[model samples]
Target: MARDTGPGLARGSTARGRGATRSPGWALAVILTLICVVAGLVPGRPGTVALAVPFALLALSGRDHRTGARSGTEPLVLISTDRHLTRSTSTLRLLLTPRPKEEPTKTLAAPSLVAITLAAPGCPADGLVLQADEECPLVADIPVSGEIAVLSYGSAGVSADVVRPTDFVQAPPVRVSVLPQVGPTLARPVSRRLSGLSGSHTSRRPGEGGELRSIAPMQPGDQQRRIDWRATARRSTDQDMLMVRRTFADAEASVVLVVDRANDLPASTEDWFAAGTSTLGQGSLHVARTAAATVAASYLAAGDRVGLDDLSGTRRPLRSAAGSRQLEQIRTRLAGMSVVPRRRHRRDPVPPQGAVVIIFSAFLDEEPARLLRLWHAQGHPVIGVDCVPVLQRTESSRAQDQTVRLTLLRRRLLLEDLQTEGITVLSGSVQDEPGRQSEREHGAPLPDAAGTDLDTGLRLLARQSRRGAGLSAAPGTARGIR
Candidate 1:
């Protein structure tokens, strides 16, 4: 930004800076020179001083013809950053642009020394430096780590910027936007129909995949090239008959993350922040995002297209996209995701045909379960991942607590309804802390999440889905950010 210092000259303050300082000696000398001239000009002036007094005093003054003819006292230094904002550890290029010098003039400053100092948060003393006669366009790496990395420059013994110079400025602070980073994922994938692409899944009805399915007697319409002579010879019963080989077709599958943002019992922002050090017990939104990203990463890494949508429908849905670049875009979008309040205008988007839709949710009600049924009815393979962490009873009367128990029982019954509709409720090993685990004694009792860890739950689902049947609705696990 440009700050108007005076007429014609403007000071560029990138972020923040203080006013300039002027030396007292220069002002005192100029005043004395004026006094000396006035005294000599008087007709009845003291006979002690004649015409020689005025010119002699002026010569001794700080202001000189050489200095006045110049624009400034010395070459003004301009400090600036390459970018106004950046993230952690990102390379920062600071440009120290000094006004061109015609010839070095003798000032109180020592030309042999060019002192450089920097003031910034999370910054060490060694940010950037310039030699006595260093050239321009120099590269300096600033080591930074924090939410905001401030930057300021200082030039010791340089009188040019001391007296309200307009050329000097402090660069703006760098804002670090550190989002959650997702790591490698573990997901067992399956695709029913094999198409043109070669992939891991074996298609049910196939023409050309390398994985062998079965060998059969050749019919009249069978291709002669597909004949398996060895199979015919091995089986005496079929020795006289021509045997043909059948193989599963290779095909790529698409996955859609059907994130359920309609959780009635989500962790409060205060509760989420209160357990700052707890790795497993973050907010529900965080768990949902992580689960969605995990599934996306697994499928994408397997060379499959992935898409994302919100049950709340507050934001525009992302269509199915392929390739490595899409992963970064997906991660960034997930990081900016917020817990949107339920809206009546929410519309249910349809998943692609033959695509696998993984729903991340906490089944507080039957609505999310009913949504799964719709996807299943449309011939899409659906998997439900319950992102609910272990629940703790709130303060209430016995009658109110009984109502909570009935609500939970109804929720469990709805889960069974999902299974009857062919959805696998993935029961994961989720629990409150050892101390909080016993809180269930004060509240409604719940079935133990059957598994050693969260991975065990996911692994169970992966195994169950291997048969290509409907699967998923597992309890939440503590799979850390990655």
Candidate 2:
């Protein structure tokens, strides 16, 4: 398999082999030849022999043999996308370029046209119609977007002209991460104890900044820039003593978003206890990704360092950074995260020292709650984001209903206990609406309600941050469903 990753483009290709059945045209020719032979057996049909000869020739014309591919090289089918990262939609193109042997022999020829069927979670089932053109590579535009799109080759059309040594070499799945559409710019939860020299948030200490901290008599080492001439004149009649303006210094905060990818429960309550057959975009993992992206973007926009961490321990944690590129990296990483069941315990993530930690999870397990207490103990302003979507009750078995009720009760108690420990709880639940089905099917942006709830939760957290009490400021803070 061949893979290419260029700027803004993702490409993967399949290697060719030999072992294909006769093509439809060959089957038709063979049937015709057999019919002609049978008809020629009739004493009255003398012209059938002539017809049988032509049909037999046609049937043998496209006989399969050693593939036309060179001994060392195989014909390739490549799939490319205009962009690997898309918020809504992108165009994917497939190209089939056949490499024939240099020395021609009695071997089979390369396929003139290659038909391919692609399968994805939310894509068409029918095989794509490809127009064969020897001069140009086959082109078929595939529209891919929404939540996450993983494309893989399904089946290829069989032809007698081409033979393979083995099955087609399957190319790796091409993953396109569609970053979530966020709502209005959110009020990022700033750390109470900020760091770094320069940022958007105002620090408690006085230095060079826009927001005035206090005004007092000019002291030694106070530059002329810090001196308030107006205040000096008003306070000192003869201008003997000068008054200087002191402003709070600007500092940046480090925020690490821990995303749990263990379970992805859907919003429909009835589907909670069922197998993992929930719709692709309508699950806890989607909500978690969306919330993490939204929060990371907001904080990054505020000149804060934001990082990403997966709780399932499937990948390394991204270091905190403040930039547009960092934001892109975080979103891409979030979009690529999938449910990875943890069979054994893994080491907890170690974020930057004194960094604020925000976790996005369904809170169905004790891991998130334990982490919340651990971060709080470490003096990091911790916020727990419940990514479980709004549940809608439906008719179900009594046992399943009891199980759901018991699970919810346990989750609620866990959250309440965390809140008692001064951990601010936030909701990132995606609401299940009537119009969401169309949006999911059509690759539209996610509902803004989820972002709105997150925004509100962070706003309250921000308010708490300003009051010198970050997580402890909001005890028992719960929003969304139960």
Candidate 3:
């Protein structure tokens, strides 16, 4: 299959094979001839013999168009996707140019129309017979798989040649982003876990013009208007000690989504075709992407800087940014990952200091455990989003079932441990129901982790993480984050 880069255009030849393209005119002639023959067999129908001769002659007239194409050289096909804003579904037009007509051996040839149907690797659209000048609209379900749409074609129509040969055409695969099932807008803005220079997250830093942090003794640089006269006078005695007001600095945080694609996508029951069924099965890639996109959009909407890191190599590494374009880029990149990546574990990147990283994975492997643990040890708040399979399923025997049970037990324990370390872990299934975290999972209580609706709690956690009791900070010290 060939790949074309720009959005919505796929051009390529079919999978290699020599097949016949036959004209329908001969089939019509055969039917007429059979009718004539039947009439002649009946009593007092001698004129039917004359009619049968003409019908037989007509059957042998049209030349099939199958002469030019040879083995491994299927006909060229053009597939273009068009979006109609008013219509909910998009349309894909397949423009087929049949092999040019050869020397006409038979007179009164069939129409130049060629019938095309999907052959190996079934297509999203039903079969269509189209003229060289005309394009047919496919009954395609758009965005069938991530960004790449898979389709194959074969000749059902006869070429304008003697013997009326046929050719099966497997068109090239294309990348397309049509309708995506983006989840509902978050009920609340995502909460960030770190104190940073600037963002929508209210910071732990003490500064001017924000929610009151506390009141303290008036210092030399303290503004005169900041004096809390009521508190100062109440605390005042024979001595002249003064009091002033303090407030927190409004700041923002950075969020990075680490999407894990390094595993065999569990076979999707939905996209996977079964015996006598056409509904396609979708898999873990869809699940992972849905969770990742949702996480990115939520955090970006909360005014936190968001970046993407994919283990699957389907996307380039994106720097953290809070912009509409960033969201679009992320979505587009995610939608285009049509192929499921092979499982390959590698070293995880060390997240930048104070960045809250969300790891989206199935959590079936131990690599995520090690990676998340490393992030935690570095003091970066890590949230684990377990991307449970949506369309993909793995076959299992009794031993596999026991193994799965053991793995789940281990997974639950690992997540519980992560929570104990202050890393937030959530299930992809319950993503929309944020309240599920409040409940115990396999007897583990979540730390009210990041992205919780409780911003104040996260703010307090950020303050704790940044306050006087950290690795770089001394027992008593004053510092400012730029």
Candidate 4:
């Protein structure tokens, strides 16, 4: 994006200044001349008055011709990037356009030096490389990390001996959002009530598809192309009996990612009550966005429809659709989600019939649980992803530690209740500790001591679906919860 920072004249003023305002050198010259004249009158030094003449000439020569000239036009900075992947190196192209003068004689000369500053979480001070030009728009490729990058420009310095006074205007800073990196491809959560459109997953009903169902006696309406010659030869049936092959219909599944943006907490319990705590690299919202994006990409790649819904906002839900564009839309919405407090709790969004509903939330309260039960009752395969960051016990008082324990206990109980109701629960939380290098590098969950990660949790969810036959099972009847 290109932007005109602002309009202002900030001239260089020093002892050598001229025009209406006399320079400090001129004042000093006048003061010394008066002292010399006083000395000549008192000590009979006749030539002292002549010594003041050189000082007067020195002040007269320090003249400024462009006192009323305007400041140089502000340079426009344009920022463009090819991709926005998290936990990875991405290049930011910065195009610097030189200031344009509306009137050549009215404006001051261009800035002599330019300074570029790049700011982001954990960004180095010497990250920016400057190569500015007076005519052409200078382009510099900046490597950035983390979620957000802020680029700013300003005047480094200016020469005082120029014919006309000049000031370099600082460009307005530009902020670019780096999207969270997507994890490994996941098994698209199959919905029991698949849509009629042809897709990767096999439907329960027999149709012209890939997966084999069964071979049966051919009916009058059965297509001749579907005749199973091998099955007909194997079966010792009546004369002229023919067999036909049957297969399940190919159908697509709709996945709606319901994200809760009410609370964004850090991993450590110590920072919970502190204001302006740095959640760099470790935040609940970060995990939720990453998980949502990864799941959306995997499902869309498998020819499934994916949609997004924000629980804490009042905007219209993104409808389910299939394509690369759908994934981009979901990622954009997820990247923009932030903690919005005091929001009126609206009615839960209803997903398409039989769509797998995955809700990402910290689940600090009962709101998310209530929605999970609601979708479960509606015969939708619901999965609740706990997005609360992993609890880190820091050097705090005993009371604070106890409070942390109690909060964790309460969350565990809530998740258990949801699981008991046949809603699959998965942990999408990540640790913020710097020691967890693997977690930081992968941007995905690492297996715990119990060998449970996001992939393991999802595999368990698939197993549960198979055991209960998702839609065929009665609501709240599947007791084998993991």
Candidate 5:
């Protein structure tokens, strides 16, 4: 069965066929020259004709040169379509000039050759394949149809199409499997972890020990028992954590997602960001979605109620909480997010006080670093995920000498700058494989920590989430940028 390999994704031949026909001036100049010679040979007016003969020959010669310059000896392509079968077949053969009054014979085969076979279900029982020798010359017995499929040989990247038969219908759809990653864990503290906290302490009545006095916003390392459940429940969703001292009821933590859209970053970096925003998986939107997903997933998994504030691409922030419906809502929002240029002079709206803030971004510029400092000053435990672009240079010829050197230098400088701050930067290139070896080889350095695979980070995060440690910080702030 012949299939229509969609445009840009075809799997077969890659060369193009030759163009048809040559310039007409070559033949015309030859005929004109002959006429001038014959006129000079005539007896009547021979002297006058002789003088004109040189000029005519000169003009004819110039015309011949012009014609020859424009003429090309490329092959002619013949594409035949079987209307009944809706199949298309193309043939390529060269046309070389022959002796006078003799027919032009097909010589060389077309250079670019491609053949596609499309077969519909329950259609024809037979097919024909064409065979060619070392030199693909035109043969009188070329097979046009039969049971075997004939494919022309040529370069790896050739362009060719197979004509389908009229009786053929569209091909059937094939099933493809999408592998899943290891399931969620408790070791990683994502924004979603805050939600589960609410359910875990739901049985305890409020106002048993602490009064609802308004104090300063809560920071990391604060006691979880002091969390203002009523205020936290009202302000944020399952994706944001709420920390409070026993002294305050309305205290909340403000979380911000700072995505960097700088010129120095790699192209399609936004795509990765978008992917993370869409899901909790480790890819693009990880900055926006990962911490949020982790927090929400962890909180819900641990019975803590939490809330989420989406600052990506919105005039007004999207706010939701930790519930079955809320989780679905967060997923839907992340999935639909598109990368947008940040507006100048506008700050991301901050969540209420005591809200656990998870900042996600590539950290390509000083803006994210500055923002992290600001959030830290305000007493929020800011977890930064640095989405680093992977550099690839397979062919030395494709890159300039200076460009490659500059890239390596830039990465080093950026890593140093990120570490200077207290941010836990995870630098991973998309080009790196998902396995442990690839992660160990290309993984970014963690602050004060040894290098580890990407799976290690993810597994740790997942385990943390499953254990209700969503808000717990790693022993010391470890930063890595690969």
Candidate 6:
């Protein structure tokens, strides 16, 4: 987070009537000149010099007036220790006032304010949590102080005590919410199916054998000794009864969602073609967030662990695990991720084994392909979600030619390549329905195949019991499992 700390003047030239007014001194000079001419004191060199004196003074006054007007309108920024300023010492303050208001006895409060506070080393950093008193206008300060930053929402009064001469770090507040439509699908299984599996069996009786039901007559191959003699004698018929064994698929699975944040796409039509065909959405980080959230929620509801690996900055991978608590941790990590440029690493770290590797990235280059290959080779199910349509068409260009065709072609190539490498590829535009392209592409028969590869792909996906598998593997092309 970077704060703007330079001079506060608005850029570009000011329009007429929008700038400082003419100085009062100029008016006074005109009045004095009138008086001098009317008095007729020699009306020669002395009169000329006398008139010039007032004009000279007016010119200086005009300059000062302009300077004062500019300064007075500037914002007065204050970084406070707390919202109420009850305690705490570390603070900074800067005052800016408009030139026109310099002469007036007026107090200026900033219409908008931004503040950032950094925690001292070893202090417990809580991150950017905002709290405000009932009387306060806006309480946008984040309490986590490792390198805390805050900005006023829209145009709001800002006051704080932490203004230093140096620049301060600022970060946007973390926003977390279940995607309304997909949330229920991700959450239902966790609370219902998983909970039932963990609970004790419901068939137990109240008293006998510590709530265990009475055993009936033994059948062939049944263990003979444990059969309740009294119950079997009463029945007078052959039967077999034993404790039912419950299977819990509620065991959690861990998934590592790898997102590539590197911006390496070209700037021309070729670049657009390249992006249009990739699995990840044109390598845009925002698309990555959406896809990651969707996948993370799905696995989380299944009682499967989820972790994040930001392919930006340092590749300090967030490990995966499932539980209500671990899910919260994953959400927090995802919320805090910031998109950054790619780093240069001659040697990339190997992805961890046994975890489902769901990579959300635009497969613009060979790097992501290599990573997916490595994960698949290690016996982990690797699913690559392609996010196409990085650019939005305007109303005027709604009927643009060739753009849509080229986009589809590139996407198809990308998906085919990935499929050949054994990585499951899913592709689709963010604005369209989720599974349309996957169904279409997977439904079509492969060239020279006896039946459609689409059917075989569906069977493979059905066997896995997870949606969004078995599609052509290429960059920038098709929409797969969402």
Residue-by-residue lDDT tens digits, candidate 6, 123-175: 33332222212112223323211122332211112233211111122322222
At residue 392, candidate 1 shows an lDDT of 56
Candidate 4 lDDT by residue in tens digits, 1-482:
96554442223443224433444555676678788878887888879877877765654543443332333345423343323322234445444444443455432344344444444434444333243344222232322112343455553322232222233345556555666668887755577678875987767778977767889999988999999988898893554889899887778878899998888767666887667554354677887888888889888987888989988765678999999999888887777676776257545577898788899888888988998999888888888888766545562888876676677667777877876876777877543356456444644233221123466677666666657654332221111122
Clashes of each: 2, 7, 37, 0, 106, 57
Angstrom error of the Cα, residue 221, model 5: value is 30
Preferred candidate (lDDT higher): 1 or 4? 4
Q: Score residue 24 of candidate 6 by CA lDDT.
A: 46
RMSD in order of candidates: 12.2, 10.2, 10.9, 9.3, 19.5, 15.5
Tell how far residue 367 is off in model 3, in angstroms.
0.9
lDDT of 3 by residue, 1-482 (tens): 77575443421133222343444556767788888888887765878867888668766664323333334244534554434323344434433445554554353343455666653233345666676446554544444336544455555335443235444455565445643355644322223344556555455577753557788899998889899988888887644988888976656567787877664244332222233332133445666677677667766776667888876654557888887788887887776654446345455576656677778776666777778888777766666776654222232456654554465566667767776876666655433343343334333233222233222333344445444333232222112221
Best by TM-score: 2
- What would you estimate as the lDDT of candidate 4? 0.64
Regions of candidate 5 where Cα sits further than 4 Å from its true position? 1-183, 188-283, 286-295, 305-315, 389-412, 427-482
Judging by lDDT, tell me the better candidate of 3 and 4. 4
Candidate 6 worst ten-residue window by lDDT: 187-196
Alpha-carbon error at 199 in model 2, in Å?
1.8
lDDT by residue (tens digit), candidate 1, 332-399: 67766655665665456777777777777767666678778888787776777766555555524666
TM-scores for every candidate against the unseen true structure: 0.51, 0.69, 0.61, 0.68, 0.38, 0.45
Candidate 2 lDDT over residue span 1-482, tens digit each: 76556643431111123433445566777888888878887766868867878667767775542232224323235455533244323344444333333565454444445555556645554454343333223233332213344566632323434322222444455555566545456776665667788887665667766667789998899898888999998989998999999887767778899988888877676877666342454577877887888888788887789988878887778989999999888877876776788545556667677688889988888998888888788778788888877655542898876777677777877877877776777778644465557545654333222233677777776665555532222222211110
The lDDT for every candidate, in the order shown, is: 0.54, 0.64, 0.56, 0.64, 0.37, 0.42
Give the C-alpha miss distance for residue 265 in model 4, angstroms.
2.6
Sequence-dependent TM-score of model 1? 0.51
Q: Name the TM-score of candidate 4.
A: 0.68
Q: Which portions of model 6 show Cα errors greater than 4 Å?
A: 1-75, 78-250, 264-283, 313-315, 390-411, 433-482
